[model samples]
Structure formats: structure tokens, C-alpha cells
Target: MSTLLLLCNQKTVSDTLTDVLRSVGHTVIVAEDVFSLRTKTAKEDPDAVIIDLPYVDALFEDIKRMSPRLPVLCWMQES
Candidate 1:
């Protein structure tokens, strides 16, 4: 029962991910932006982070700084 921090700005994507993760017994915390993401990351100390934001690289660096050992999974759109 690991807690996961989900950073997504899109409503549909966030909702879908939250539901799916919850169904699999993983606790999901959704953050729509970097501010919330940082706050939640500190408060929750989630096992892993799933990011689907506009600035992936920058966000990833920030997250790494906050929690170096924490696992991160990034989602990107192919264009």
C-alpha cells in the first residue's frame, strides 16, 4: 500500500490515474502544479512520484532535489 504523488494539470488524465491507482490499492495524491506538488511531497513523503506536466525536466530536477532517493515516473506526449 504505497502512497504515490501524482502531478498532472489535465483533469481527465489526473482523474483517470487517481482512479486506476486507487483501485490497485495505492494511495494517490494529486497536485495540479509545482507549488502543490512541492507541498504534498514534503507532507506526504510518497513512495514514488508520477509527473505529467509541461516542464518535465525542470520539475524532475526540483523533485530530485527535494527527495533524491524517491522514484519518479514521467509521462510525455509524443508529437
Candidate 2:
């Protein structure tokens, strides 16, 4: 199983996803904001990440600089 870091501000969405991932055996760490996201990403060095936010372009670039090899899955809302 992989350690997955999840960055999502929406409480309901984050909670539901966390439960689902944990049930499947992956260790999921949640970060509700940018500061925590960077802190956890640097400290935890998760195998992958899931970004579910309204704006992710800048954050996505920032994360890449921190961990170029880390895989990212971005969740965008339909307009």
C-alpha cells in the first residue's frame, strides 16, 4: 500500500475520500490548506498526492518543485 497525501479544503469531500482510501488499505494524510500541504509533503514524502481544490495551478507547480517525482491527481469541479 502507498502513503497518499490529500490536499482538499472541503471537509465533506476530504472526509469521504479519506475513509474510502483507508478502507482500501492506503495511508491517507489530509491537508486542508497550503501551509500544511507543503509541510506534510516535505515531511511525509507520500508516494502520491491528490489535490482537490478550486485553484491548483500555482500549488501544483509549487509541489512539483518540491517533489518532481511525486505523482499528483488533481480533482477539478465542473463549471
lDDT of 2 by residue, 1-79 (tens): 9999998877888999999999999999998689999899999999998998887888889899999999989988665
lDDT agreement of model 2 with the native: 0.91
| Per-model CA lDDT versus the true structure | 0.91, 0.91
TM-score of each: 0.93, 0.93
| Candidate 1 residue runs with Cα over 4 Å from true position | none
TM-score of candidate 2 versus the correct structure, residues matched by position? 0.93
Native-to-model Cα distance after best TM-score fit, residue 10 in candidate 1, in Å = 1.1
Per-residue CA lDDT of candidate 1, range 1-79, in tens? Answer: 9999998878888999999999999999998789999899888999999998779899899889999999999988664
- lDDT score, candidate 1: 0.91
Among these predicted structures, which one has the highest TM-score? Answer: 2
Error of 1 at 46 (Å): 0.3
